[model samples]
Target: MARFFGWLFLIFLLGATYFWQPDFFQHSYSILKHGDIVSLAEYLRSFGAWSIVVTIILFIVMTFTIVFPFMILSGAAGIIYGLFWGVVISWTGEVIGAVVMFIFARYFFRQIIAGWITKSKYLKQVDDYSAANGFKALLIARLLPLAPSGIITAVAAISRISFKDFMLATIFGKLPPVIIKVLIGHDIVFAGENMTRLIVLVIVVIGVYVGLWWYKRHKDQNKVKY
Candidate 1:
């Protein structure tokens, strides 16, 4: 009963947004198509005291909607609020959005998913691995920025991971990328006056990816030896 209502509510919200604010969707699409960070910032600022609230809501909406990439809004936040507050605001929205999606997936779909997983030996092993290292796996996924945020949240939701582990991993893992995007966005708007800083951040991101790859290979080699 509750599950039915929950799904109904989500559908309603999506429909309402689509129908009630057609211009809002069109405008967001336009900004995304042109990659116009400056205009996005200006649009947000036009909201006056409500700008922060508006930005957060947009981030939440972005989680379910794929029309725009997440970085555009994060960058706009940086342009509007600067580094520290931009990260704080964007992170808060992202966490909230992710948690909402996770809860929905877990509550409504986990049972159906469990049956599917049990039928496949490969999937069962993957599920076991996720159950054992949910935190680490989720954290790495969040840190890498390779998968869509919605997909990661959904996969974790259906796994054996506890809510506490999910929340902690999410909070910590999301911080770095948010900070990086904010920095890159801010620097880009300034005509790359901070080119050196941007280059250093790029290198750090590459190093982290390399380290993760090496660790995965080493772990796999150990498994084969056993």
Candidate 2:
């Protein structure tokens, strides 16, 4: 029965990816880059109480695919709903997306994932380390802007980290970056000659990239030493 369900999920996931990916890949990120959010928001508001529901649903789909990552949706959410509601909606959607992917990867794709991880020493190391230090491993990685949310989900799933640790780490780790992106979006949407906040947001983004670069350099150096 379990094996049957495993195959069932795999087939369904494959079909969904095949049929749904082309359209999404072509335009999803493009929407973020160029779509008129004011118009989009107006359309959403036409849905009345269901507008946020539609937003959450689309957000979850995008997150689960792990194609665009969380940042793309983060800014848009804030644009549509302001910072506080944006953060709440984004946090919920991202968490649900991660949990769904994690479960599917851990169960339905375990064998395939195991084979792939064995081919990469770094991934194997992460898996082993996560098994030992679930909370710290996930929290630290998720906190780092360098760490892609998709990879974090994969590692946690493969390692089968406890729900408590995974849940806590995800909540804490994802909060700050989500806050940053949403604020940037909010400021941009409501900007009226006060460009200082935008300037600061840009600086913060640059700092995140620089920090990631420095950490990677240090990590690589340690790797060479060992």
Q: In candidate 1, what are the lDDT values of residues 1-226, reduced to their tens digit?
A: 8888988998998899789978876787788678888999998888899999888878877886745667788889998998899999988988998898888889999988999999999989988988889999999899975347888888899998889999999999998888887777777777558889878877877888889889989999999999
- The whole-model lDDT of each prediction reads 0.85, 0.72
Shift of residue 3 alpha carbon in model 1, Å? 3.4
Q: State model 1's lDDT.
A: 0.85
Candidate 2 Cα misplacement greater than 4 A, ranges: 1-3, 6-36, 115-125, 145-147, 191-194, 216-226
Q: Mark the 10 consecutive residues where model 2 has the least summed lDDT.
A: 24-33
TM-score of each: 0.89, 0.75
Q: Write the per-residue lDDT of candidate 2 for residues 27-96, one digit (tens) a residue.
A: 4446655645554455456667886776676666665665655555666678777779989987787777
| Number of clashing pairs per prediction, in order | 0, 0
How high a TM-score does candidate 1 get?
0.89
Cα distance off (Å), candidate 2, residue 36: 4.3
